[model samples]
Target: MNFKGKSLSLKEYNDLADILQNKYGMQFLGDYEALCSNIAAGKEEEKNQAKPEPVIKQGQGDEEKAVFIRGTIRSGQLIRSEGNIVVLGDVNPGAYLEAAGSITVMGKMRGTGHAGTQGDYSTYIAAFRLEPMQLRIGDIVTRPPDGKQYKSKVPEMAFVKKGMIIVEPYLGKR
Candidate 1:
């Protein structure tokens, strides 16, 4: 009865509904679109209402805390972590992320990523495709140049350099 942990398209949902009704004699209360919308709304509500729990793991000689996210961050969502943060998906526009440690995105970043939120300038933000609306490290911030477009789809890293946030293409092993 629960569809959690599964990603299904409209057609797939409809097919499942049909199978359930025909084979199991189970009746669905709402239409396909309505059901999907309700599920999405519920998820958004849960995210908005839920509080982030601290994650702790044993490191080489101490305990390290990090937050890991596996899905795209939509607009209006804010992800704040007391330690490092790693996102496996893209960060959409209007979304925000603040972390006391480094922030890493396995996909594109088009939102605001504020690393070193606790004033640790050594922290950095790295993404597979960096085209963020804003990048912040400690007290420094950087934005895309006016009327400038980055054509390369290479990975990039941003860090505080000389009191300013500098973003450069990530070569290997930095």
Candidate 2:
């Protein structure tokens, strides 16, 4: 499954195809079994896929960076960015990441990450896992608990709660 540097699969790209094809239908295509019947199935196939675009134009003033990185950050790699950052692949141990805003991992991160590096408490960091060697936000830092319960779990998010960082479950957008 090393699809790194590759385009998204048709299946992965089409998960929300039906939703995109409908704007104001009485019944959404994915709402219920019966509701799906009324929606035009062909619409999904007819809709054109929108490719990604850069957040900032090349000639834009001030040159704001909303996101940085598009590949695996292996062990020992270090990334210091002023805006949000994304790792399209795994982040191996010994890697260091610092972002002023949120950080998203379309893959796994097993290194050290510090979102809110600019003291932005609103920062959020998410990966295919929350099992990093260390996680931090602003001036607060916490290492993954060295126990069985954490080592076996899946991907999650880390956010501040009660003036402390608390790792919690993340179900994508929800």
The clash count for each model shown is 0, 0
Error of 2 at 104 (Å): 1.0
Q: In model 2, where do residues sit more than 4 Å from their true spots?
A: 1-64, 172-174
**Model 1, C-alpha of 50: deviation from truth (Å):** 21
**Tens-digit lDDT string for candidate 2 (42-113):** 345346435434332222111256556788898878887667778888888899888777677777778899
What's the lDDT for residue 11 in model 1? 91
Q: What is the C-alpha local distance difference test score of each model? A: 0.81, 0.68
The alpha-carbon deviation from the true structure for residue 126 of candidate 2, after best TM-score superposition, in angstroms, is 0.5
Tell me the tens digit of each residue's lDDT in model 1 across 1-174: 545546568898789879989999988655777777877987897799787454432221111556899999989899987788899999999999998888999998989999887778888899999888889988888888879765447899998788988888888755
Task: Report the Cα lDDT for candidate 1.
Answer: 0.81
Enumerate residue pairs that collide in model 2.
Answer: none
- Collision pairs in model 1: none
Candidate 1 vs. true structure, TM-score: 0.62
